[model samples]
Target: MVFSLKGKTAIVTGGGSGIGKAISTTFARQGAHVCILDFSTDNGNNTVSEIEKEGGSANFYQCDVSNQEQMETIFDEIAKNKTINILINNAGIAHVGNIENTNSEDLDRLFNVNIKGVYNGMKAAISHFKKHKSGVIVNMASIAASVGISDRFAYSMTKGAVLTMTYSVAKDYVNEGIRCNCISPARVHTPFVDGFIQNNYPDNQAEMFEKLSKTQPIGRMGKPEEIANLALYLCSDEASFITGSNFPIDGGFVTLNN
Candidate 1:
C-alpha cells in the first residue's frame, strides 16, 4: 500500500508527452484518478486513450498553463466533483542560448511557460488545498537550476525560480497540511530530446543523441519513467514528512560533473 494513490485525484500539467506523459501514466497505474492538462489536443486525447486501454481512470483537459483564468477555471472545475490531492507542474518549454544569443522574446517565451505556468498551477490549487487541509505538489525542475549548464540561460533562470517557489510554498503551507517539492532531472530521454537531436543534427542524430546522453555521469540520460517514479513517491503518502526539498535526479551530473 506504500506509495499508493488510490482514491486520490492527481492533476498533471503537460501530461500529454515526454516526462509529463510518463508521469501521467504512472500516476494512473498507481490507482489515482488522473486529470491530464495539456495544450495539445491530439496528444492529450491519445494519452487518455492509452490510460483507458490500461483500465485506468483519466481525463484530458486542453489547457494553456500560462493562462491564469483557464488554469483557475479548470482547477476549480475539477475540484468541484473530486478532491484535489496532488498537483504536478510538469509543463515547460526549453530554450538553448546564452545571454548574448537569448533575446528578450526568447526569455519571455520560456518565462511564460516555465515560470508563470508553475505559478498558475500552484495558485489555482493552493486554495483548495488549504480548504481540504491536505495536498501535495511536485514541480519539474532541471539540474540547470543549480549547475552551470552552458547555453541554458533562460531555461536555467526559470528553473531556479521553480526551485525557490517550491521552498516558499512548502514553508508557507507546512502547517496547513500542504507539501511542495520539486524534481531536478539532469537530462531525461523523452520525445523532446529525440526531436531536438533529429531536428538540429539530422545528419548525425544518433551521434548527437549519444553525446547528450553521455553528459550524465551515469553514462546515459535518465528515463522519463525514472523521473515519473520519483514524482509518484513525492506525491504519495510515503513522503508525508518530505517538503521544501529539491531532489536532483541528475544521474550524478550535479555532483560528479566536477
Candidate 2:
C-alpha cells in the first residue's frame, strides 16, 4: 500500500527535537502540511524553517501541551487555518526516581505532561476530527508502559496511562472514524539520553552511554528516525485497519529482555 500523506494536515506536539522532530520531519516529507506544537519557540521555529528549506509546508506554534488554556488557544488558532487530520501526542517529560524517592510533585509533574498532555491534545483535536469525519491519533508511549524499568516509577505510571488512553479513545471514537493508537519505544538515542549521561556521569559519559546502549538486546539504542519510520506507517492510510494497538518499536527489549 502506498503510504502517502499528500494534502493531509498533521499536528505534532513536542516537534522541536528528538523523536518528535523526527516524526514531524517524516510527516512533512510525506507531503503533509504539518503544525509543530512545541513549548520551545526557538526549536519549534527552527524545525519549521528546516521543513520549509526542504520545500515542505509547515508552521510552528509555541504551546505547552499540559496547559488547558494554552492548548485551547492554539487549537482555536489552528482551526482557523485548516482542519487537523492527524494528532501526534509526543510531548513528554521523563523522571528518574523509584517509588520511595518519587514524591507527589514528581508524580504529578510526570502525569501532567505525559498523561494529561496526551489527553489534552486528543480532547482539543477531537472536535476537528469529528467535524471532518476522519482523523488519526498516535501517542508516544514507552516500553515502560508494558514492562517495569528501574528508576522509572513515575515515568512508567504516566506511560501506562498513555497506553490505556489510546485504547479508550480508539474504542469511543471508532464510530466517529477517528483511529487512536500508540507506539512504545525503548531507549532511543536522543538528546535526552545524552543530557542524562552528561548530567549524571560527567566523567564517564561514553562508558555509561555504551552501557545504556547495551541494555537493548540489539546491543545499541534505537535511533530517532527508526521510531519515526514506525510512526509514519502507523499514521498513514496503510494502517487504517489498525487501531487501539500498542506497537513496540523497542530493539527486542520488551520481549527478549532478561
Candidate 3:
C-alpha cells in the first residue's frame, strides 16, 4: 500500500516547534498543504519558511487553541479557501508538579490548553469533516495517558482525557468516514527538554539529561522525526483501517519500564 498525502490539506496545532513542527514539515514533504498553527507567530512563520525553502506548501496562523472564538474564526477562514482533510491537535503545555504542588490555577491552565484545546479544535473541525464526509483527527497524547509518572499530575490528567476524546470522536464518526486516533510519546529529544534541563538543573545539566534519557527503557529519548513518521503513516490512506486507538511511540516506557 502507498502512503501518500498528495493534494491533501492538514492543520497542525503547535506546529511551530518540537514534535508539532516535525509533523507539519513531514506532512508538507509528503505533498500536503499544511497550516502551521501556533501561539508564537515568529516560530510559526519560521516553520512556514522552512517548508517553503524545501519546496513544500505551508502557511502560518497565530492561534491560541484553547480560545473558542479564535479557533472558530481561524477554522472558518481556512474552510473558506481549502478543504481540511486532517486535523492534528498537538498544542500542549507540560506542568512539572505533583498533586500537592499543583494548585487550582495550575490545573486550570493545563485543562485549558491540553484538554479544551483538543476539544475545541475537534468541535470546530467536525462540521467541516461532516460536510465533506471524510477526514482524520490525530491527537498528541503522551505515555502519561496510560501509566503513572512522578510530578506529572496535571500533564497526565490532560493526556488521559485526550486518549478518551479520540475514542469518543472515532465512535461517533465511524459511519461518517471520519477516523480519530492519538499518538502517545514518551520523553522526546526536543528543545523543550533542553530548556527544562537548563532552567531546572543549571549546575548539572548533562547529568540530568542523561538521567532523563535513561528513563526510557531503550536508554535514550525518542526523536521528533520518529514520532512524525508514525503520524504520517496514520494520516495516510494506508491507515484508513486504523482508528479509535492510541499508538504509543515511547521507547518501551509504558510496557517495559518495570
Candidate 4:
C-alpha cells in the first residue's frame, strides 16, 4: 500500500503507447480509475481494453492535447462525474534535428504538441486542483533538457520549458497542496523507437537501433515499465513531500557519459 492510489482518478495523455500506456496500465493496477487521452483511436481503445481485461478500471478519450478547447471540454466532462487527483502530461511529439536542419514547420509542430500540449493539460488541471486544494502533476521531460545532445535543438527547447514550468507550478501552488514535477528519461524502448529506426534506417534498422541504445552509458535502452514505476511513485501519496523536482531517469546517460 506504499504507493497506493485507491479511489484516485488519474488522467494520462498519450496513454495509447510507450511510457504513457505503461503509466496508464500501472495506475489502473494500483487502484485508480484511469482516463487515457490520445489522438490515436486504435491505440487508445486497445489500451483501455487491455487494462479492463486485466480487471482494472480504464477509459479512453480521443484527444489532441494542443487543442485547448477540446482539452477543456474533456477535462470539464471528467470533473463533472469524478474528482481529478492526478494529471500526467505525457503526450508529446519528438523532433530530431539541429537549428539549421530544423525548419519553421518542424519547430511549429514541436511547439504545438510538446509545448502547448503540456500547457493545456496543466491549465485544465490547475483549476480543479485549486478548488480541491490538492493535486499531483507528473510531466514527461527528456535528458535533452539538461544535457547538450547533438541534433535535438527543437526537442531540447521544449523539454527545457517543461522543466522550468514544473518548477514554477510547484512554487506557485506549494501552499495549495499541489505538487508538480517532471521525469527525464534517456532513451526508452518504445514502439516509437522502432518506427523511428524502421523509417529512417530501413537498410540498417538493427544497426541503428543498437547505436541508439548504446548512447546511454547503461548499454541498453530503458523500459517503459521503468518510467511508469517512477511515475506511479511521484503521483502517489508517498511523494506528497516531494515537489518542484526534476528526476533524471537516464540510466547514467546524463552523468556517466564522458
- Give per-model TM-scores: 0.99, 0.98, 0.99, 0.99
Clashes of each: 0, 0, 0, 0
lDDT of each: 0.95, 0.93, 0.95, 0.95
lDDT by residue (20-132, candidate 1, tens digit) is 99999999999999999999999999999999999999999999999999999999999889999999999999999899999999998999999999999999999999998
For model 3, residues 1-258, the per-residue Cα lDDT tens digits are 267899999999999999999999999999999998999999999999999999999999999999999999999999999999999999999999999999999999999999999999999999999998999999999999999999999999999999999999999999998999999999999999999999999999999999999999999999999999999999999998999999999999988977
Clashing pairs in 3: none
Off by over 4 Å in 3: none
Superposed on all Cα atoms, the candidates' RMSDs to the truth, in angstroms, are: 0.7, 1.0, 0.9, 0.7
lDDT for 103 in candidate 4 is 98
Q: Write the per-residue lDDT of candidate 2 for residues 1-258, one digit (tens) a residue.
A: 377889889999999999999998988999999999999999999999999999999999989899988997888898897888999999999999899999999988898999989999999999889998899999999999999899999999999999999999999999999999999999999999999999999999999999999999999999999988888898898999999999998889988988
Clashing pairs in 1: none
Candidate 4, 188: how far from true, in Å? 0.4
Model 2 alpha-carbon drift over 4 Å, by segment: none
